[model samples]
Target chain A: MPVYSEKVMEHFQNPRNVGEIENADGIGELGNPTCGDIMKIYIKVKDDKIDDIKFKTFGCGAAIATSSMVTELVKGKTLKEAERVSNEVVAEALDGLPPVKMHCSNLAADALHLAVEDYKARKAGKGPIGRVETPEHDENEHDLLEHA
Target chain B: MKIINFDHFAATKMRPEVREAMEPFFMQEYGNPQSIHTLADEPREALNKARLQAAELLNAAANEVIFTGSGSESNNLAIKGTAFARMDKGKHIIVSKIEHFSVLNAVKALAKLGFEVSEIPVDKYGSVDPMDVKNALRKDTILVSITHASNEIGTIQDIKEISKIVHENSGAYMHTDANTSCGFISTDVKELGIDMLSAAPHRFYGPKGTGLFYLKKGIRIMPLIDGGIQEFGRRAGTENVPAVAGAGVACELAKKELKDRTAHLLPIQKDIVSGVLGSLDEVYLNGHPEKRLPNNLNFVVKYIEGESMLMWLNNNGIMVASGSACTSKILKSSHVLSAIGVDPALAQGSLLISLGEDNSLEDAAYFVKELPGVVNKLREMSPLYEEVKKKNKV
Candidate 1:
């Protein structure tokens, strides 16, 4: 049997929104270097709806296919509607991945959820990550001060 | 469709002549070799001839060769049987990190059986260093198992040097799995100072269900199979007479054609490898350039998955395999790749294309012609490639 469904190969060969959004309102990056799978999901929100969504994935065919399918499934949907998209829904949209590639489906769903959480955090003015704080110049930067 | 098969590491088609040699034993003279009957006499003679042929190929005595069910069974017999028999002397065993799954899993099983298993590390080219084997050896170490050549990267080990260390430095029995190396390289067991050698007949165009297990004279190993006396009471069962006869003929042919086959296979490998590496950027060969087998070509193409590349290759009528045979559908990278310290991401992109008696320069050309477009397609869709480009721009 073929390891992938025809739809999975289709999405893999022609993945949609396959680049980074320069100013994405919400971004989610998840990876496990041990398994060599990494994915980033980006969303542009407008009026509590996902106006635009894209992804960048560095993984197997299943990962790229799921990323493409997840983007197609979530675009123009309300936040609540987008949040309803599960790994099963994404995998089903792609005619189902091999049981071995089910983890790739998890990568798709988790990345989207992380992005949504990032969006919620930004809207609450408590952005959780992606900030580089300016370092204060100190003479004792290389040396530890004596603690009391 | 014309299919170009480069998965010889996985299996090879049985030679027609060898099949013809075996055809009679399947039914006409089919009998248990051990039974004392008219039907049994032909099978017994066939078994003896098969053993002799295998012995001649390895330059060993016919008595030393024991036919087994398959290559993996031979390995299991060599490692586990040896360890179990010699447990009174020691409980420790040493094996190379880049051994085939049979050896690795056998070692793992020994570990659970309370044996101390030390997996010696390999070099960057996936070749086991003799000195590393020496260092891993201890007074209690009973057996040391290493592959003659890697099935993944095809790096031929210096078994003569390593086995010398095993025999001289300690009382350990030295074993090598020569399944992939049998026809591709010289596997004179006596010359290599190897105590035990395992080889599968199908690897050299023989039928499946047959393999060779050679143990040095006077070396005792406990039987993995406990039944009626067969294979000198080492392996016990009704032997598959037809397959065994085929293996004998195949071994004889492999020995006769060893030099010719190597001469024919090397150019085909070099042609494909040079074509792939010349045209592709961010790609590198997987094993030692000079120390590899004649027909093995392994390369890693960065920023894409091997499964994806395999799908595209299959579509183009090219048959090859990735490092990892998917285990339970998880795309785990090969242990051989991990042992060589390849980046996990790049290891996921590994490809192994092993040539056999049938491959040619034309097949290599076809592969080179079709590969670039497939690689390009995958890379264009890869975010890793985009990141690499952006980084290079900076």
Candidate 2:
């Protein structure tokens, strides 16, 4: 067993922000079946700021807790501010993750950045930021959909 | 953090009897076993006696056993040494897909050397069919290396049946990596028809850094290391005398307590399996339900990643393995899980609780009681679980 911090365990045991947002302004999904971690972030952007944020993560406890914490950190923040939310902050929010599972928090940060980026790109008339290409999909088609 | 540290795995510290048996080798008899002096003679005699003790446990002659640094080294020596020694006879080898990386990687290295390697598949329960081995054999095949028990899933293979098939076709040498099964399980080389076998003592309550490879006499194999004669010149290195003595004591202890140890573990294993299965929905047992090691309980919880589950359990003061300890450093799914056709999502959630002789019924009960809540909590936070749940609901 790897050493997980107390806060990480706390959030893992009683995680917040577990469900997806309905009719979300932007949806950001990252990871794939192959990597064994998949996170989907749902955001509701209002007045160019994140009015609401929620997440559903398919991963370890650290990952789910990180996703739950990432949502709490980004809600009510501007798209730019949310984009600046770092993996370190997510890990810090949970106290700290085991070294091997640091990637789980990183995925949480990545999901947030992706959702905020989608909001920014949509505001710029570049349409929504494209869906992230997983190992299985074609980037071109996904990018076209993002710009659609 | 809790003020008092409770390690579930290390709950039973080293027994006084085993520790006492190992004390003299370290304190007073530290002479090299190979030296010609009187002090060396005693250590050498002790080393030979350790060999005989280990051999007696495996039901093999003392001369057949060669001590090595680890199970991985012994496995490497067996596969590579035999391939090179018998190259003139054949350049093909067969192994099961669920074998440890030691065996799989050794065979891969052999392939790089231009040998034809075939990996026979296993059933969903991770048991290899002897008929698969028989069908995979070619006239040019020189060896068939299978595991006595899978490390990940704990399925005990039918070595006796597999060896009979190997012997019937082209007289291929049969080898088994018994690193996980040798001590707790009763192993008889003749009964199993194994020409070469490997064992690691650490898994059996012995000190680490001691392993044994049993090579039947007249079954020629080249040496992986070259140095002054050691281990009958089969492996060349100064013997780890203290560790070997500890291993011999551990083997003797295992021999005396095998029946009781297994009897005690059986219910714990069954309870763990039943508890996990009953508490959780969509949980799958990863190995042969009945033919598994008495101490092993492996399960795949669909929504949580294995590493995270391990971390959560660790935080709760439980010590368990997510996959083979050797492959835990990497984040990739277990090859054994993949080969057995476990879904990628569930494979990420695999957990193994390998009970040592010291693990009590209370420990198993505690894990069973605590684990479902952990899984539920992780799932509650998981978007994938939410999505999967939604999909199922619809």
Give candidate 2 misplaced runs (Cα > 4 Å). Answer: A1-16, A65-69, A86-105, A120-133, A136-148, B1-14, B324-327
Checking candidate 1 for backbone clashes, the offending pairs are: A100-B329
- Ten-residue region with minimum lDDT total, candidate 1 chain B: B323-332
Task: At residue B31, give the lDDT of candidate 2.
Answer: 91
In order of appearance, the predictions have TM-scores of 0.91, 0.89
Against the native chain B, what TM-score does each candidate's chain B reach?
Answer: 0.98, 0.94
Using DockQ, give the best candidate's number.
2
Q: Candidate 1's chain A scores what TM-score?
A: 0.83
Residue B295 displacement in candidate 1 (angstroms)? 1.3
Model 2 iRMS: 6.5
Which regions of candidate 1 fall more than 4 Å away from where they truly are?
A: A128-148, B324-331
**Best lDDT among the predictions, by candidate number:** 1
State the lDDT of candidate 2 residue by residue for B211-316, as single tens digits. 8899998899999998979998999888888888877887787778889888988987878878888888978888897898887777888777776777667767
